[model samples]
Target: MKKLIFLLLAFLAACTSTETKKATSGSAVIINETVVASAMERIKTSQPGVDQTLLEKGIRHAASLWREEDGNPSDFIEFVKANYISDPVRRKEIFTKISNYMESVNGHFNDITLDLKKNLDEAAGEIDQIDQMYGNYSVGSHLSDDFFSNKIAFAIALNFPYYPLAEKEKLGPGWSREEWAMARLGDLFVSRVPANLNQALNTALGNCDMYIAEYNICMGKLRNEEGKQLFPDDMVLLSHWNLRDELKANYANKENGIEKQEMIATVMERIINQDIPEVVINDPDYEWYPFSNKVMQNGKAIEAAREPDTRYDLIVKTFRAMKDIDPYNPEMNTAMMRKFSWEMEISQEE
Candidate 1:
């Protein structure tokens, strides 16, 4: 997910800034222009030959489109239907246009809250019906918005297919623009401010704790507690494990400014390095297991194709490492290999 990548980017930047402007003196807003600049530089440096001029053009077009269709509710629906029948090239162009509304240069964090508040209302109205029919509604900042199908911003999030799509082109898992922004703030904005986190392990743990709390608050605000939650249980659990593991891995490399990385690692060790692995999303062996009996028994273990993700090789290695740490744990060692083989079998049959 881009949200996770953003966090990793922040971790990589590791430029802890303390530029805060005080309103009354008790607290201050740390809109570190230096941090933003540095972060942007890091991103550009990593992307190799990404066309800056082209990206800007794309973002501007998308914002213009949203602005033009601003008042109408049905516009997005028509927009989605158009995409459903679209070929890859068309889809790319459409999303390139949509990307403008969310480009980092335009102002990644400015008025972000207001932007989401406005868009959430639009998303809520559009996604409710889609959710009822497709099993993936209520996935955006708004209660009814199905972000996965609504905009290119959310669509690109499927850069790594988190799950194996069942039927026709289905939605993937991730936070919406608003959700992504909020999490970015927690990861980049809040963590950079002068705090105890950069000093000692406890302080670092404190920062992680603060991040987790802030994350919950953001979630609570964006996804109302009493509202109907639509994300699949297994998917949600996977996100939890993933976020936990990411934090752990990020914290593990404590050179330079990564002193706080251990706190996350400490917490995750509690989660994963347990006596008995716990079930995630009804699948007890989901996180720990290397094989799925269903897949193995079906003989898909020998033939299922590996799923696509952020980086196919990297994902496989991560799973392999998980398996390696406890080679005796068959769940860890053989789950993905078997499951992937099975998936291939089903695909061929269809």
Candidate 2:
């Protein structure tokens, strides 16, 4: 028994060692969660403090999209990378396809939102119709809320790498159950993100929850609850291994920076001012919120957009603030710039 136990321990040690070797040799580190975690690690360990600013911005957007949707981080990462194929022509083709797909989903979502709002409005004005839609206390609004949960969420599961023609034909057009899935998949083909994926995500902004939910279900990455419960659907898990905490931490910093930029700026101001009263505000002990850089306009930077209308719009938005900053600046060629804008806008009609 002692001899057998010694042999078994040796066997287990060898197997564990082999597994670790295989992982280090073959694994690729990637994910929405992983991106955040890895980014934070790089920032933390930088020998000379690498600029993590871009990573932060990208991760913030990723977190918003990730938190509000459902799908495997792996699948999403795959989709993002694959669509960025090197061949320019092929890249354009894939992007255009994704763009149209997004348009279809967006249009559908908009129509649904408008129709529901109208129905609720009518019900509110009429007690008779109220029974039809508003019978249960605020059930009418609840129905709309449920619709958002179901329909308005982003569903980005795609099926774009062409399967064989035979496989395509297996999905024959019909009024059968399998055909229903085929029809839904057909919409997937139609919703292409134009030119690039960021645009596609923008286009799919208000729709595609079903696709996102379905992808999560397939990858077994579904969260128990999130968003407005925007994504809820059946999914299958193909493999095991989860997004690392370090990655998620990267995105967490991103989230904090984006929503709290003003606060960060205000802290910097107080630290610079060094006044006793401001010290209370500056106390890093409290959630030291400095006025964010969002409000602090850059005079030189604003002047550098190289287009009058762009400058005009900036001036218009921060007119009160900009006026104070550059009081000596002469009036811009408002008429010529507007003409230049009109002509440039008209040129696009071609």
Candidate 3:
């Protein structure tokens, strides 16, 4: 589930508006350093005694992310003045409202997906290729586009600026829930991923998920050295989670437990390594012997080539597509790091 969610949102930062990078840290800024410095000075001069340090930080941070679509320096300054909530109480109130709205939207979208794709997702009925494709389609791909177009993204960035993982780690322990929520809100607009790339990512992930869904190991057709079936006729395990879980479940049956576990492990390794034969996967027509590395059909040994590294290829595809967004996300560049440290709130060391 986390993997699926990451597939959806991790690419979101890459799908920003076509406003182009103006004041990004690396790029030669259209809104140059001088322009930004002047804007900050103006804000500071205009709003005296308004947490000068925070005001400076917010202005600079927002300027760094500001694009051509977000308006010029004067417009940026005015937006900063209007939207930057100075009072902690008022800021918290706004954050709470936004948080509640976000929760509601997310919850409803989740429910809609679950309900709409019940046939394909829940394994309830015969789902064709079309059904599968439709089920895997993303619902929230355009969310970033909409938010940024409406200046909601700018508003959030101006008020609750982002903190990198390192900073969060150092300061997070003492932070209240609202402060943490503010940090999370800051997390959204850190980078903008193009919508097309996000669509590609969604398509790639959806295909991988569909492949996994159809990848079932017929347990009853699995044979050992003596050509004896170890599992019940109706038993089937989906790769690789269910198959792995079945392997773990055999621990109590000491008689053949280790052997069964070893066989399942071997199957998993073959799948992961892309050595599993194309004919035996999800097809009960062929009985497979993991130990002997053979496939038998109609009780006769037949030659079949190994799978074309589709499983491993998808993993690579996912990583490559995700890695494309690393440059955009300065804090948690890699998707794995983002998943663990940012989204799951678990540090790498932990």
lDDT of each: 0.30, 0.31, 0.76
Worst 10 residues of 2 by lDDT: 221-230
Model 1 worst lDDT run, 10 consecutive residues: 216-225
Q: Write the per-residue lDDT of candidate 3 for residues 12-47, one digit (tens) a residue.
A: 555543332421433222456777677666766775
Is 1 or 2 the stronger prediction by lDDT? 2
Query: Candidate 3, 211: how far from true, in Å?
Result: 1.0
lDDT of 1 by residue, 1-350 (tens): 67976786466334323321121131222323343234334434554554554333222222222322222324433332233312435545645554464464335443453343342223344433333222211122231122322454323321211222231123213546643333222111110111221122223322333222222111111111223222223332223445455445554454522432333343243333221222221232222222121112121223323322323233333333322222221222233443442233233221
Q: Pick by lDDT: which candidate is best?
A: 3
- State residue 314's C-alpha deviation in candidate 1, in Å: 33
Clashes of 2: 31
**Native-to-model Cα distance after best TM-score fit, residue 278 in candidate 3, in Å:** 1.7
Q: For candidate 2, write residues 1-350 as lDDT tens digits.
A: 57975785465434432323333322222245565565445444542343354334333333333322334565444433332233436534645665676577667766665664453334245334343232222212232223224432122222222222233446444346633443333333211111222222222321222112211112121111121111113323211111122223334565443333332233334333332122222112111112321111221212111112322233233322222212111111122332332223222211
Which parts of model 2 are misplaced by more than 4 Å?
Answer: 1-64, 67-83, 86-88, 119-350
Q: Which residues of candidate 3, in runs, are more than 4 Å off? A: 1-32
Clash pairs (backbone) in predicted model 3: 13-192, 13-193, 14-192, 14-193, 14-194, 15-193, 15-194, 16-193
